[model samples]
Every structure is written in C-alpha cells, then in structure tokens.
Target chain A: MSTGSAPPILETKALTRSFSGFTAVNSVDLTIGEGTVHALVGPNGAGKTTLFNLLTGFLTPSSGTIHFQGRDITGMDPERIVPLGLARSFQITSLFEQMSLLEHLELALASGTGLTRKFWKSVKVLGRFHDRGMQHLEEVGLADRANQAAGSLSYGQKRALELALALALEPKLLLLDEPTAGMGLEDVDRTIELIQRLRHGRTVVFVDHNMHVVGSLADEVTVLQSGQILAQGTYDAVRADERVITAYLGESHA
Target chain B: MSEHLVGTSHLETAATAAPERRERAWARPLYLLLALLLACALPWFIYPPIALDILCWGLFAISVDLLLGYTGLLSFGHAAFWGSSAYITGIVAIETGMPFPVAILLGALAAMVIAVPTGWLAVRSTGIYFAMVTLAFAQMLYFVANRASGLTGGENGLQGIPRPFFGMELIETEAFYFYYAALPLIILGCFIAWRTVHSPFGRVLLAIRDNPARARALGFDVEGYKIVVFVISAGIAGVAGGVFSSGHGFASLNDLMWTTSGKAVLITVLGGIGTLWGAMVGSGILVTLEDYLTTLGFEGIGIVTGTMFIVIVLLFRRGIWGSVQQAWHWALGKARLRWG
Candidate 1:
C-alpha cells in the first residue's frame, strides 16, 4: 500500500527487443510512478503489448535494463519476479477452460502465496483462501458468478474475473492488459468504477486502444508506436498535441 | 447430493473441498490387505513360478502407470531401466549373496543412476517428443546390453539368481516361496507409489500435465520436477524387474529389448492411460488372458489385445476407470437434476 510522490515503482532504461531479425521494440524508456494509474495507449501493432511483455517477463529485452524500486530486474523470469510483488493479468483471457472461475482464482491465489503444488495436505486449511477470494470477487462485482466456468462467462464478466484474480495477488504493481478490452458500455462503465477503486496504494500500468478510458483514468499517458515512445504527458496534453494526432490518427483524425 | 446441485461448476468445487481429502486416507490400506490376501493365494492355486512372474510384471506395469496416469508423461522406454535393473539385480544377487532386499536396493540404485542422465534429456521435451525420446533411448540401452558380453549375459543372460527367504534354502517343492518372497517388495513398492501419488507433489505433476506453462508461470521448477518423478518411476520399475529376476532365476538381454517396454505400454493402454489401478487391472486381464489363450492352443493373443486397444481408444477417452468415473458423474448429475 505504497503512496505519494515516491520514485517510480517501475522504469525501463533504454529497453530494446528484437525478434527474428525484426526490431519489434527499440529503446523504449518509460516510467510508471508509485500508486499512480499510468496508461499506455497506442494503435494496434504499435508495440504497446510488446512493451507490456518486456515489463512482465513474458519477453526478454535485447538490451538495457528494467528497475523496480531501483533494483535492476532485467532478464528475470516471471516466476522469480512474482515474489517481488509484481503481478499481471493476461491480454488474452488465459483462464483454464475446464476450471471454474472460483477454482481458477483459488489456485492462482494459492500459488501467489508461494505455495507449490505438492503438500496438498494443506488443502483442508483453505478457509483463508475462500474468504480472501470471495472478497476479490466482490471487488470486481463478480461475486455472483464466482462458481461459473471462467470460459463460459460473457466476454466482459470473464475480464472482470481476470481482474479479480489479479486483485487476489494483492500486488504492489499490477499490469492490466486491456482489462476492459471487449465489453459493453455498461460493462465498460463498471470496469472504470472498479479501476478507480483499485488506484489507491498500488501502482497500475494498463494498455488500451480506447482513448476515452485512457483520457478519463490516466494520471499520465505514454504513447507507443512501433515499439518506441511517441509521446509522454498528461492525457489532455498528449491528446491535443498535433504530433500525436498526426502520428496516431492517420487519415481518421484528420 | 448437494455437490451435484452445483452441476459442472461443482466439479471444481468438489475437487477443491476441504473435507474430501480424507476419502483416500483409509481406502489405501484396505487395498493393501486385499493385495496381501491375493498374494497368499497365488501360490495356493497356480504354479509358484507363473504366479511369481505375474506379480513382478504387474508391479512393473504399476510403476509405468505412475508416470502415465498420475504424471501424464507417456514413456515408451521404461523397459530400458526395468530390463537393465533385472540384469544388475541378477548379477549382484549371484555375486554378493547379500540378502534379497539388499540386492534389490542395489538394483534400484542402478536404475536411478541411469535415469538421471536419460531423464534429464527426456523431460526437456513434452507430449509425442517425450515418448519418442524415451523409446529411442531405450532401444539404445538394448543395443548396449546386447553387445556388452563382459558385464551383461551377452544374449544368454546371468543365470542361477538366488533368494534366501525366511532363513531356509529355497527348494523346488516350495517354488511358491518365490511368490511369498516377492510379496513384501511388491507391497512396499505399490504403497510408496500410492503415497507419492496422493501427496501434494503428485498434484503438482497433474497440474503440469494439464497445463505446464501455467505451472511454470506459478514458479514451479517444471523440468526438475519431471526428472525427479522420472527417476522415482524408474526406481519402481527397477525394483519390479529385480523381483522378476529372482523369481525366474535368470536375467537376459531379452529384458532390455524394446518389446519388453512395449509390453508395459500395451498394459497401460489396455487398462487406461491415466488410471493407476487400471494399469494393474490391465496386467491382470492381459496376463491371465494370455495364459488362458495359450492353453486353448491359440498362440496369437496379440490380434485380440490389439483389437481391444482400438476399441478402448474409440469407445472411451477416459479409459476403463476414467469412463466409470465419468458415467458415475453423468448418472449422479441426472439424478440431481431430477431431484432438484
């Protein structure tokens, strides 16, 4: 529950990534301040997802470093980074199709506590898990659908459950990859309310193509294009800039 | 009944329940007593040698099933370890005269030693590649066993392997003593396997089988876990093979052959892939059927067993035990829907 004008919780120093002789991301330096809602907005294929991947250990950077709380964490695997209080919900809904939504989060929450698969003997003592898990489901307004198959949930409810599982981690830094990616207007409004509630005491870095969400919730905005930082400022400043308009809008904004 | 009310969603709820963990606590020892009674009767009704042979083979299948059903890694070359241990156990028992159990320990050590190197490679891959790598390596072990005449039996195999059970010079009149002697080893082996499967470590293995990448993301040492289980599985197979050598009083290159591995695979498939006891049931049905068919002057149990494999594959993805589980669920589900 860190707060205030403290140092950036996550920062990339000249981070670069190349794949199969193609430069997917190049020298994209970004900073996400502690307990702030940082939005990364870009067109499709603008390497926002690639930057998210690098930050979250889904992809290794070709060069440069990532620092969390001023410690160089470059090239660390996702498993190791998790114990350091960084957790991420997936871009694609990667819920176990066969598992119930409650089961999915219970297992996630259990593992997030650094519990390994063996020692199933402690399964009898899972009362704390249920209590905390139900609280998380309540947070994202998914308490009613707690027992549903995650895959069977409507597109928006699935996203909400995914958010609830991320909340279960109680992470210092949360990476939400398009948390409201495919939702109805009502679902999107609920997601915004949920996001607002989550922005205190924990840092949130999210990527979305939706300008409206970004404009409303972002404390600061970083715009990416082809893996490089195209612009960085407050939402109004970046949205009003002619460069952002010309670079991102193409013929549509004109 | 309340469990069924949640419907398919309850499958996870039931699986995740705190109270259901106690179900298997008592069931295991009950099975052990039943195994003891069966072992006692093996020598009573059948020739001691044949019954002893079945026990050894059955234990071998059980070991393979641990890897297949519980761990979800289908190994086609378990014979490499099982066969090699038979030779080692056969050689050591004759050379050392160091009691039966001690010799079996040495044999298990040998198989475990081999598994470290081979399993390191096998666990690096998954699915069809895992099976292929294991099968290829086993064939490699077979060739080495065949050519190494100085240490191994070269084709003839080590002979006159002996076991002193109950402080008596084992006599032909008491060939059934082989069954009696191998009983404790089989029981110990099965008990450990069952215990390990029921443990948290086994659940992790199931998690790995269902979704390995997720397990990795959750901070599991996925490959390391696989290699450890591989070695343990090999050790169990080794002990089973060790018992086989003593029962037959011989161990040969035939033990190391690919067909030796295939036999275990055949039993696993016929019994059901992921059902551990189903493998045991498979061994019982297959071995007994072969014995019955041979008496009827029908030498080709292959054609019949082969057809059974196809039918089982097509008819039930859950295999024998799994299908029974699925049907029980479907019935319970229907009953609940009606009542509710």
Candidate 2:
C-alpha cells in the first residue's frame, strides 16, 4: 500500500513504545491508504491500543516516527495532532456526562471553527452550529436524544455518541479503538452499519475483537501479536494466514 | 408515513420540554433581582462594615467556585491573589493617591500577572497535587510579605487605605456609602463571571473538567483552558481583596494567610460549590454569623462553623444552595405531573 502511486494518508515507521522494562509496541511499520477502512486485529495483550495511542499522539513512542498526510507528527500532543485532520474515539467511551448530547456535538463543531476559545462572547453565538450539530447527531441515530445528558445514554448509545463526536471533527483519518468492544449483538450490528456509512471519503483505522466486523468493514487488515505485525493484507488473506490462525483466531474460532 | 409519525413525536417531546426549561431559566433572573434588593437593604438591618464584608467575601467565594466548581481545580493558595491585591491596592492608594477604582484595577492586574506563572506551574498538576502546588505558592507569598516588611508593612499590616472619592464632592468613602459605591463594580464582576460560564469558553472548561483526555483529543488545549480560568479566577478574587482592604482602610497579613483561603473554600462549599449565587448566600451566612459571635464575645467561632460544616456535608452533599435547587426541581416535576 505504501508503494502505491497515491501517497498513504497515514504512515508509521519503526513505531515503538515501552513502559519501563515492558515494551507495549515494538517496531511497528504501518501504512494506511486513503479512503480505505483498515482494521488492526490482535488478541487482548497484542498492543493494538498502545499502537493506536502512538498513532493518535496520546502516548509518545519510545523510538519511532508518525506521518499524517506526509507530515511528521511523532510525539506531538493529542491537541495538536487533531487539528491536522486526525481524530480518534477511545476504546472505553469518554464524554462529558453532564452535558447534553447536542452540546457535546456543538463543542466539537465549534472546535474546528476556533470559536471554542471565546470566553467573552455569549454561548448564543454557537447557535450557528446548531443545525450542523443536529445533522451529525442524526447521522449516528442520536438526534432523538440530543437534549439528554450523555451520562443517561446506554452503553451502545454512548459509543455511538463517541463516534458522532469524532465524526464532528471531520477528520481526514479517523481512528476507532475497539469500536464494538462490550457492545450487544444488536448494538454491534448498528455500529458496524454506522461505520459502513462513515467509510466514504476518509481513511479509517479500527481495532476490534469481532472477526465478523473485521470481515465486513475492513478493506485491509493488519494482525498483531506480541507488539509485532503477524500478517498484513486483505481481510481474507490475513484470515487465511497460518500465524494469525494459530496466534489469534484459533482461540476465538475454536 | 412512519417517518412523518416519528418526526411529529420528536417535536411533541421537544415542545413538552421547552416550557420546563423556560420556567427554570426565568427563575434565575427573578431570583437575582430579589437578591439584589435584599443586598441593598442589608446595611439598614446590620452594621454597614459587616454588610460590606459580606459583599467582598461573597465575591471571593464566587472566585473560588469558578475554579473548584467549574474548572474542577481545587486551589488552596487563592489567598495569594486576594492578599497581594489587598496590599497592592493599599500601597497604590497611599503612595500614588489614585482613585480607589484605579488602584483596584492595578491590584487585579497584578493578581492576573502573578497568576500567569502560578497557574502555568500549578495547572500541570491535577487534584491534590494542584491544590498543594497552589498552597505552596501562597505560603511563599505570605513569607515574602512577612520578610519584605518595608513594602508590605511586615507583621504590622498595611493600614490607612483611603477610599478616594469618584470625582464628586457628595460621594463619601464611609462603609455605608462605599458599599453602595462598590456594589456596581461587584455586580459587573459577577456579570463577567456569569457570561464566562455561559460562553463557549466556559463550555470548553466544563468539557475539560469532565474529561481532559477526551477534550484534548477533540483538539482543545486543556492546559490552556485551565491556565486561562486560573488567571481569571485570580483577577476576580483580586477585585474582592482590593475592595475589602479599601473598605476597612486596612490590608492585614490575615488577608494573605492560608486560613483566609480556607475560609473562602468553606463558604463556597456551604453555599453550593457550583452555584454562583450560592457564594453570596454562603458569604452572608458566614460573615453575619461571625459578626454575631464576635458581638457576643464568643472567641471559639470556629467550633460552631466547623460543626455546621460537618452537618451540612452529611445532610446536604451538594451543599445548601445545591440542595435547595434540587428540591425546587423535584417539586416542579411533581407539580407538572399533578397539573398536567
């Protein structure tokens, strides 16, 4: 993918992170093509989340480089990285529990316009973003709950809201960390459908334990084991690989 | 179509929610007006100096609330701003003979300047560490004030802070007159704070307070918001301090002590940590009680206030104003159920 004529939207070279003596992500070289949904699949301790953290600038890599749209973004702060068209949703849902869903979307919308820093102006000025915020909420099937506090949302709904928030950023490269983790079967289907709709015009990198979600949504799949890439190719190619079956798929499939 | 039915139902729910939201909104301005009237009449009921004390302390508590309640920053060194402003206001008044308002402005600006470095260092830490860092800074300032006896009046305290007239012969700087004179500025400060919390900036602060990591991911400079709020809070506290010192013609070491910071925090918790109006309520109760006890020759006022604090915490976990607001909403819900 990196060797293709069209430049990759996101690329990582020798990406590595360690916590004291324990290395979480070791020498990961990843390349994600534009407008394609990429899945990072691994077992529980396979360093998928740590790799996401490094890519999104949440955690600084011990030794590595991250490039977004050909710009070096290694060890940059999350706040700085986001403005460059990279956004991520956490594995565990994170939100302002007391704020209404619409308010959350409005804040995300206002963030892009540089209006979130205006302490002197009345919040009424954000009324301009109201319709757009509702549109984003509607996209995630959350428009009906727009007025409710985020804390009142169910597990599935909160994950949907998190997706809505990341989408509000209008990021060029969207990262989803275990987007279907802990979701019900019904919710999992809805989320997969939601991601399917969202996959147009942007690059997506997601970590998931659900092979079904991986098969349906992922155009390319990278399987990891013990902080190293075990297989990288199309979903079917990676699924058929012997190392992946023995290291990851064996336990779940068996 | 089914879509039409869903849309109509959504509108129906929205319509039902609107009136309750409006009713709650309308209650705020009305309560504010009533409070204003009560504040205007307070001097007539009690000693004017004590009334003035209530106003200053009320503003102080509100400043603390801006950090503790809104930004989720617990500052234990707010006395640095309050005391520094008091000392600066006194010094400016005595040396430059500037109008008290100008002096107060400079004092507030000084507080903001101090906050830049203090907040920059302190905001990098969270929770108890943030509080400890702030307390350490305040203690440093306190010792500096003590050691620099030549400027800060050392242990003697800065005295004879004049309440300069506002370019009119009829205006007086007496406690009663000054209370009315200062009330407008205090109201303006309160208005600034109110506008701040309701502004986009305030929403970001709330977002940061709720989940800093998520906020950062959303492209918000969470540390920047914290520092900005910290400085703003200090400036407001500075205004209160300047007014307090000028009102009494005294800027004492007590104003800068860690105890003073504790007192402001205690009052905020008493009133309701997050409610702006609660600061005033807490201040009124605390200042009035202190005055009443002093008049009765009671030396151990802390004992009574501490016990009250414990009881309030146990019974009203959200504080007095918070509990009252909650009950009001609960009653409103019940009334709606019955009437509608």
DockQ score of the complex predicted as candidate 2: 0.51
Q: What value does the lDDT take at residue B103 in candidate 1?
A: 81
**What does candidate 2's lDDT look like per residue over B57-128, in tens digits?**
999999999999999999999999999999999999999988888898799889999999999999999999
After superposition, the stretches of candidate 2 with alpha carbons farther than 4 Å from their true spots are: A1-6, A249-254, B1-21, B24-26, B166-173
Worst 10 residues of 1 chain B by lDDT: B1-10
Interface RMSD of each: 7.4, 5.0
Candidate 1 chain A — worst ten consecutive residues by lDDT sum?
A: A117-126
Q: lDDT value for candidate 1? A: 0.76
Q: In candidate 2, what are the lDDT values of residues A60-161, reduced to their tens digit?
A: 999989999989999999999998999999999999988888899999988857787888999888888899999998888878878877776667778888
Residue range B1-340, candidate 1, lDDT tens digits? 2111111332344434322112357876896679678878877886677777677777788788888877778898999888888888878877877777778878988998999989999998888999999999899988898888777868778878877554676542267665676688887777667766765566567667766765555555678778888888898899989888877788888888878888898777777777676676777777787787888999788898788878888997666766776676678668878997
Root-mean-square deviation of every model: 5.0, 3.2
Error of 2 at B171 (Å): 5.1
What DockQ, on C-alphas, does every prediction get? 0.29, 0.51
- Model 1 captures what fraction of native contacts? 0.19
Candidate 2 clashes between residue pairs 3 or more apart in a chain or in different chains: none
